[model samples]
Target: MQQNAPFELLSQLRSEAIALAAQGLTYSTQSAGTKNIAYVVNGVNFYCEATDVKEVSVCENLMIVPQTKAWMRGLVNSKGVLYSVTDLSLFAGYGRAIQAKKGHLLLLAEEAVQSSILVNRVIGFRYFNESDEMSSLDDKQEALDGLSAFVDKGYRADGQDWYRLNVSKLLASEQFREVQ
Candidate 1:
């Protein structure tokens, strides 16, 4: 045996363990640039992969977690589990002057909390393998709160351009606060 063969064997074992763990993780199929992922709530699109999402199931109704306060738009039952729903269109600025309605609900169990983002209806899912996104949102619109990071730019809708959404922040914003 070689002089350092024992250490090499140990290193090989560690590499195998890492590979095994990685194999356990799964990533979704990336969509073509600007291919179109129907809006769950107007401009707000759901973007998730194995890295942050495992599986997505349709919810009949998610129970409202009142503690979430204004951000909470009642709740829906997701696979027997309750998820707090947020009027995503209203939460994403798409509802600027429009009113939110009862439509489809997106159950996001990514991190921190499992939130329900209410959308009009899930048209479909999109994938982006290689794409161009904006550097960042303009500082002038800092108060926009639910601003996107310009990920996957050039997405057009009705001759208009759009960007990807930030799921986490949308769930944490004060957009739900009413004029009390």
Candidate 2:
């Protein structure tokens, strides 16, 4: 009877392990698919990888810096950490953001950059499959003229085109690095 008891417990444990493995496989496959959270800046749709954004906050109490470019809005202190805020609309040649005080700030995930960009609003997430990707933006080139260097890809979803912003490339660019 004791020997049978041990064998039964082992069988139960093996089944549990098998069930857990199957669940893990399903979760991994679901997360591996492409999804993007789109945000709007001056009426244009833009998105970056989920890992590229650290946090989002409302624009408030920004300390203006001296002698910086127009696009460089100012510095903001968030939770004891200082972040340089760039006005995406102004930087992308879309003119000044009308609702500067009522805008949203996207804190970048870069450790060394410690910067964020101000946008008009956040439009929420939208999952895009491979079929939605556009190889070229030839027809809409003028629309993204200022951001062409940082935009690597585009997607069509919900009757609008979403541009993928490469945060790493934008942070490393000379134009972005030089605030003056």
Candidate 3:
């Protein structure tokens, strides 16, 4: 046996544990660059910072609240916690999301405000570097003109334009505050 072998093993184990914790906080399908969770709402692809996401699951048994805005999908109980779910597609001026047999919800990270965003599907995690960001939207994509205010940046990958949404800004918006 080598001297100080036990101490060295413990040190290695500690380092590995820390790395694992960080990976949990920063989710990604790719190994390099900033991490994001890709999701689709009404055929539009969007990415949210991985750190801002708490969970993604198929939401069922939604309890619709009367006299609320059209975009409000109502309350859903997940893991004994009640979350106010919003139809992001309708909120963004798009038509209502297709209410199928099942629906997906992206839960926001625990913070001052708690809510879930109704999405068509969770498209898995994505990775993008600073260099991957595009300077502006394409000429034909005029409908996305106002989206710049809610996004951190825009990127093109896998033949699709992905907008990195700023969740914090979305949460802080007056429109969001008036959801009640």
Candidate 4:
């Protein structure tokens, strides 16, 4: 056993070095350029800056608020923080989201917003090069109709167009602020 001690230490150091290198590679890939968190709302694909989302969790334990807008799902207490929840499908005029057994809650990163949006499903992080961006999405009028005000850019990847939703602008818009 004593004779193998040095070899064991070397093997452990090699493993640790490999692990650290992999972590650094992932960080470089994610931080070197922008990545988007893709999600589906009413069967439409949408993207938001990964940095804009602070957390993603299952939609559960929602406490309905009284006399609010129809699209306002209610309040959700997550990690001891109260967030106003909105049904993205309904809010975007795409109709109500299908009552799935489990939906995703995208918690915004902004401290002042204190809001989360419910989506049909989350498609995970997607990376798009600058060449993938499209200046105009004229063919996707139906999907952009209600979300146009919040979406200023679009990208195509994996044979689909992903509309980027500016969560900051959406949260700051007068229409969203008028939630009575």
Pick the lDDT winner. 4
Show the lowest summed lDDT stretch of 10 residues, model 3: 139-148
lDDT of 2 by residue, 58-102 (tens): 988999999999999899989999999998888888876536688
TM-score of 4: 0.79
Model 2, CA-based lDDT: 0.84
Residue by residue across 1-180, what tens digits does model 1's lDDT show?
898999999898778767877989433335434443444445444443323332344545444454554535676655566666666555545544223344665566564666655567666666444433434446424333344442323243344334555555444555533412
lDDT of each: 0.50, 0.84, 0.78, 0.85
Candidate 4 lDDT over 61-178, as tens digits, reads: 8898889888888888998999998888878898666452478999999999899989989999888877778878777878776788898888887788889999999999988877
Q: Which window of ten consecutive residues has the lowest lDDT sum in model 4? A: 24-33
Backbone clash pairs for candidate 3 read none
lDDT of 3 by residue, 28-89 (tens): 33557767899887777889989989999787888988888888878888888888888877
Count the clashes in each prediction: 13, 0, 0, 0
Distance from true location, Cα of 83 in model 2, Å: 0.3
Q: Which of candidates 3 and 4 is the stronger one according to lDDT?
A: 4
Tell me, by TM-score, which candidate is best: 2
After aligning candidate 2 to the native by TM-score, how far in Å is the CA of 91 from where it should be?
0.6
Mark the regions of model 3 whose C-alpha exceeds 4 Å error after superposition.
1-30, 138-141, 145-148
Better of 1 and 4 by lDDT: 4
Cand. 1 TM to true fold: 0.49
Report the poorest 10 consecutive residues by lDDT, candidate 1: 149-158
Arranged by TM-score with the best first, the candidates are 2, 4, 3, 1
